[model samples]
Target chain A: MNEIKIFSPATVANVSCGFDVMGFCLDSVGDEMVIRKTEKKGIHITHIEGFNLPYETDKNVSGVSALAMYNDLDLDFGFEIEIYKKIKPGSGIGSSAASAVGSVFGMNELLGRPYSKRQLTEFAIKGEALASKCEHADNLAPAMFGGFALVKSVSPLEILEIPSPKELYATIIHPQIEIKTSESRALLPKEVKLEDAITQWANFGSLIHGLHTNNYEIIGKSLKDVIVEPHRSKLIPYFDAVTKAAINAGALGSGISGSGPSIFSLSQGEETAINVKEAIEKTYSKAGIEYDMHVSKINTKGIKILN
Target chain B: MNEIKIFSPATVANVSCGFDVMGFCLDSVGDEMVIRKTEKKGIHITHIEGFNLPYETDKNVSGVSALAMYNDLDLDFGFEIEIYKKIKPGSGIGSSAASAVGSVFGMNELLGRPYSKRQLTEFAIKGEALASKCEHADNLAPAMFGGFALVKSVSPLEILEIPSPKELYATIIHPQIEIKTSESRALLPKEVKLEDAITQWANFGSLIHGLHTNNYEIIGKSLKDVIVEPHRSKLIPYFDAVTKAAINAGALGSGISGSGPSIFSLSQGEETAINVKEAIEKTYSKAGIEYDMHVSKINTKGIKILN
Candidate 1:
């Protein structure tokens, strides 16, 4: 296939207790991209739509990520990419990750599947670093491998794909404000109390167990972030009210999607997710903040071919 | 129904990455007790054997735990417990937990099992606190519930029972030295680096995923303790050497069991577990330390009726 069209999905990182390590893919919210083979032996971002982003190859996340993969391969041909961006940058739902993951995924496909998903994630991380200014796979893994992803370590790049329950759905509310990943990350403390760290890890382990067993109650109980949320939540307006409202509306749990501004709730059913979305809409609307909302079933497949 | 004889299993708590939250029951290493229904109104410690311990109800862990459950219920009959202590105290192998769980399990059995394993664990925690000087259910949860157990929190008393892979076996070496749980616990830093804590929780979540999926390689990779082991291992002689030896001998992983002095290794099969046992025995023999060792399958059932 000389030309291909793909849909790269958005992702939610730092799922409650799994700060810096966990993330999950979204089904409906994403960006559409088109890639075509070219005789010229280099990468190019020919066109872009719906969001102001650089067209320069080095400056664009898709260009940077695709170049990272393209440079290593001794291919006879190059590729041109066009992104129809939908996810807003710095909305905390892995906007950069969608762009970053899209190019590499498209290139690997056009190159006759030369790289593994893990290898594609490595290329995506370079692009992601352009936005976060740090290397983390929390978003990249789920965006590549789909479903729930737990990054055990970054150096060796170990990512475990956790099973998503069939009935699980995600409700996301993006309050139309930018919270840069680097700036939000800087708000965290360098040291945490050993007691609080223990609590955090316990919750993380329990949440993983709950996912494996399909126990919604256990999953709900374990969705607590004792370490990072206390400091970061202060930056997001009405964070507590939205969380309380989502939980009261029967979400399994609610927390910051990535860093801030974008809040997410996980529910056992689509109806409950929609209810959580309405509750968040009411809460955010009352707060007088312009916001975008989405309700999606957990995406089991990451990047999909639109063609 | 009147009298019950029980064999309560030993447990290894703080399984590597799951420090302060995870534990697993052992099949061959445990203690036996005979609990009899008495006409008198309180817990009684009638006979003692195998080890020096208190006869007073309040001082003995078994009697203390039994009393905690007994007092909570308005029952006509009291319990008479005869001690058959086989596990050594301060050996870091949940010795107190075995005795503590034994009486409560037997009483609940005789009392028609009114208390759940979770409730029995609550009673057991009171007895465990008498030894550790802290209310933690890492050991008690496994000794009561059997298999791998993760105590998510002690305050609300949440315990999750994790599935044990069928081929898994444990090799434990008790290097005849005393390291009190309270003393070893004090060795930990009041604060830990945020990066290390993140690594710890990542490993913990991955370990739980490995257990649920029965992926032994992931289990081996995840069996790491970054926060607690570095300081605690210093308290145990030849800890580094034992761990190195166990891994070299095909053990999945090794670490300080519970607190210190006693070291444990997990292996995929009984043959590998026995091989790990030999490696540890040989290493300790050269180090000129007197020690006792046992090889046990993962005890899926916590307590047994020996009749």
Candidate 2:
């Protein structure tokens, strides 16, 4: 295939108790990338759409990811790529990951699918690093592999796909604001109390169990962040009011997605998801913040080919 | 019924990556308590068996647990309790938990089963506090609720029972040595690197997934403790060699059990558990340390009543 079109879904990282370790894919909101083989020896960005991202090969996330894949494969051919960013950048719902993951995913298809999903994720990390200054796979892994992915170790690049409940629905609200990923990350505490850390671990363990066993009650009870969110949520407007509204409206759990400006709530069914969206909308609307809302079931399939 | 007999199984706390928050029950080792109603006005310990534990109501774990339950229920009737302690004290295999749990369990039965398993765990925590000077339920929860239990919070005493695979077996080795729990706990660093903590959470998340899904490979890979084990293992003789031997003999995971002079390994079936026991025996025998070994399937039933 000389040309390939790929769509990489948005993702929610941290997932409350699982900071820097867990994430899950979304079905509806995503970024699209088109890659076509070229006679030139290096990757190039020929066109851009939606957000104004860098076009330079070394600077753009897509270009960086494509170049990494190309170097790993030792491919002789070059590729021209175009990115249509639908998941707005810096929304904290894994916007950059869609670009980074889509680039490697599409490039792999253009290069005859030489790399596995795990290997593609590894290449995509370089792109994520370009954007965030540090390589993290919590977003990239789920965006590449689909569903819930756990980054067990970054050094050895161990990523495990956690089995998610089928009825899980996500409701995300992206407020028209930007929270720079680096600055948002800097807000987290350097050292966490050992007591709080143990509680977080227990909740994380319970969350995983609930996801695997389809126990929504356990999931709801365990969906608490005693560490990161307590610090980072301050950056988002009306975070507490919005989350309380979502929970009162029957969301199983709610929290700032990734690093905020986007907040999400999870529920069991589509109707409840829609209700959660409405609840979040009421809060954001009252706060006078323009927001985009999406309600859909979890994306079990991550990146997919687009005709 | 005027008299009731109860057996509370031993438990292994920490479980590698989940320090102070996770534990599982053992099938073979435990404590037995027999409770009988009396016309007397107060709770009493009539007979003590095995180890020479304190017989005072406030000092003995069994006596403390029974008194806690009696006070909670506001019962006017008196009770006489007999303790038969098979699990060694300070063995780090939750010996005190077995006594505390068995006491509350037998008392609950004798008092007509007024308390839920969760409530029983709460009362048992009081008993554990009498022994350890802190109210912790990692061991008590599993000993009360059975299988694997995660103590998500101690404030309101929230415990979640985690599903375990049927073939999971535990192999425990108690070397003839004493490592005070307080001293071992003090050896842990007060502050952990955020990076290592994140990795630990990932492993913990993966371990939960592995347990629920019966995925042995994921369980084996995730059964790593980077924080507590590295510092505390120095207190146990032949810790490294025994763990290496167990892993080489096909034990899926091995680590120090709680604050230990005891170590445990987990495997798929009874045969593998026996092999792990043999592997541990070889190492300890070579080191000239007398050790007691027990291999059993994961205990699904925490406390059982006997005639």
Candidate 3:
């Protein structure tokens, strides 16, 4: 094929108790990229839309990820990419990861699908590293592979797709504010009490068990983040109020989406998801903060080909 | 019924990466308890065998656990318990947990099974606290519930059972030595580097996923214990050599069993379990350390009723 267009879903990383190990994809919010095969031997971004992201081939996530894939394949042809970003930048909902994953995913399809999903994830991670300074696959893994993913190890690039319940829904709220990734990360303590670490891992293990077993009560109980949330929630406005309201409204679990400004919750059905969204809206309205909310089922199809 | 007899399986707590939250039960090694109904209002231990344990109701785990159950039920009739301890004390293979779990389990049956498994576990933890001076349900949960269990929260007593593969086997080598739980626990650092803690939680998450998905390779990769094993392994003789030998013998994963003088390895089949046992025997033989080895399938039945 001469050209390809792909839709890469936004991802929720950390998942509270899981910290850096767990994440899941959302169906409604994401970034779209169109890639066209070109005669030239180098990648280029021909156009950009929506969010004002860097368009430089080396600087942009899409461009860098596409370039990484091209170099890995030693391709004879290059690609011209067009970006249409729907997910907001610095929204703590994996905006950069969608761009990075969508670029390599679309490029690989146009290049005869030369790489496996895990291999493509490696390229996407290179793009993610450009934005965050440290490499992490929590967002990119779910973005490429769809559904809930566990980043078992980064050195060998081991990623496992966890089976989630069919009726699981996601409610996400993006408050009109920005939290710098580096600044949010800097708020965390360098050392953690061993007792807290045990509790965190126990919750993480329970969360995984809940996903596999489809136990909503266990999932709700396991969603607590005693380590990172207690420290980072101070930076987000109305964090406690919003979370408490969502839980009261029947959301299975609620927490900051990635860093801060955006918060999300998981529920069993669309009604509960909508209820959670209304709860979040009510909470934010009381605080007089403008927000954008989306309620959707978990995106089982991570990156999709759009003609 | 005049009395009820039960067999409570031995357990391996911590399970490498899981520390205070994870454990599994074994079929071949355990403790047997017999509980007879009595008209007295207070529980008592009438007899003991195979181990030099206290017969006083308050001091003995079996008697203490039976007492907890009686008090919880507010029952007029009491129980007279006899303990048959087959699992060696202080071998780091959850010897005390078996007794604690077996006592409550048998007492519950004699009392017409009024308590749920979780409720019974609560009584067992009371017994465990009498020995360790702290309440922990890691071993007791698995001993009472069967197979692999994760103690998500100790306060409200949340335990989740993880699915295990049908052919999973455990190879345990118990060296004839004693390591006090308090002494082993004292070796751990109160604070852990956040980086190591993250790695640990990642491994723990991966291990749970592996168990639920029946992915052996993932289990092998995630069985590493970076937190407690490093400190506790120093107390066990031939810990490193035995572990290395078991891994080399085609075992999927190997590590110290609990705060161990006993080391265990997980494998997929009988052949690998046997091979691991032979390898451990060879290692201990060279070191001239007396050891007892048991190779068996994962215990699907935690506590069994015996006529």
lDDT of each: 0.92, 0.87, 0.88
Q: What digit string (tens of lDDT, one per residue) describes model 2 on residues A1-307? A: 7898888899999899988888999998998888898888889998898988888999998889888888876656788998888988888889888888888888778767888999998888999998888989999999988888989888789888888889899999888887876778789888877767777888899898888878898889989998888898888889999889899999999887887878889999889999888888887888887888999789998899999
TM-score of each: 0.99, 0.94, 0.98
Among these predicted structures, which one has the highest DockQ?
Answer: 1
Which residue pairs in candidate 2 have backbone atoms (N, alpha carbon, C) closer than 3 angstroms, thus clashing?
A: none
- The C-alpha RMSD of each candidate to the native structure, in angstroms, is 1.0, 2.2, 1.3
Candidate 2 per-residue lDDT, tens place, B1-307, comes to: 8898888799999999988899999999888888898888677998989999887888888888878888876666789989888999989889899888887787778767888989888888888998888999989988888899988888799887888899999999999998876788799888777777777888899988888788888888888898889999999998999899999999998888989988989999999999988888887898887889999799988889977
Weakest ten-residue segment in model 1 chain A by summed lDDT: A177-186
Answer with 1 or 3, whichever has the higher TM-score.
Answer: 1
Best by lDDT: 1
lDDT of 1 at B182: 67
DockQ of 3: 0.89
Please give, for residues A1-307, the per-residue lDDT of candidate 3 as tens digits.
8888889899999999888878899998888889899998889898899978787999998888888888877767788999999998888889899999988998888767888999999999999988878899999999999899999888789999998888899999888977777779898988899999999999898898889988888888889887889989988899989999999999999988888678889998999999999988888898877889999899887989987
True contacts kept of 1: 0.99
DockQ of each: 0.96, 0.73, 0.89
* lDDT (10s digit) by residue, model 3, range B124-208: 9999988877999989988999999999888989888898888899999998887886788789889998888989989998899
Weakest 10 consecutive residues, lDDT, candidate 2 chain B? B190-199
lDDT of 2 at B298: 93
Ranking by DockQ: 1, 3, 2
